[model samples]
Target: MPYVNIRITREGATSEQKARLIQGATQLLVEVLGKNPQTTVVVIDEVDTDNWGIGGESVTVRRKRGQ
Candidate 1:
């Protein structure tokens, strides 16, 4: 089985968008790694802005600073 994990900031991605992500990930694995779509697992984790960090600052703070 092939497993794919995707993380994004919790910014209210629509359900359709999430579904597309899962489908795209599965298709990519099937095309590149020859994995079976039926057995592939794609997981999306959404971290809160306050809990996610980049460039030594939390996403919440970064957005506040407009960086």
Candidate 2:
């Protein structure tokens, strides 16, 4: 079984879009690595912008600063 973890900012991703991400990840494993889609696990984690940081700044603050 192949497991894939996807993390994204908890902004405005719709349910449909999240579902697509899961499907796309699964499909990529199937097509590229010959993994079985049924046995592949994809987990999507949504982190708050404040909790996610980059370049010594949180995503929330970075967005506010237009970085």
For each candidate in the order shown, give its overall lDDT on alpha carbons: 0.95, 0.94
Mark the regions of model 2 whose C-alpha exceeds 4 Å error after superposition. Answer: none
Off by over 4 Å in 1: none
lDDT tens digits, residue span 25-54, model 1: 999999998998999999999999999998
lDDT of 2: 0.94
TM-score versus the correct structure, for each prediction: 0.95, 0.96
Model 2: weakest 10-residue lDDT segment is 29-38
Clashing pairs in 1: none
Model 1 C-alpha RMSD vs. true structure (Å) is: 0.7
Model 2 vs. true fold: TM: 0.96
Q: How much is the lDDT of residue 51 in candidate 2?
A: 99
lDDT of 1 at 9: 97
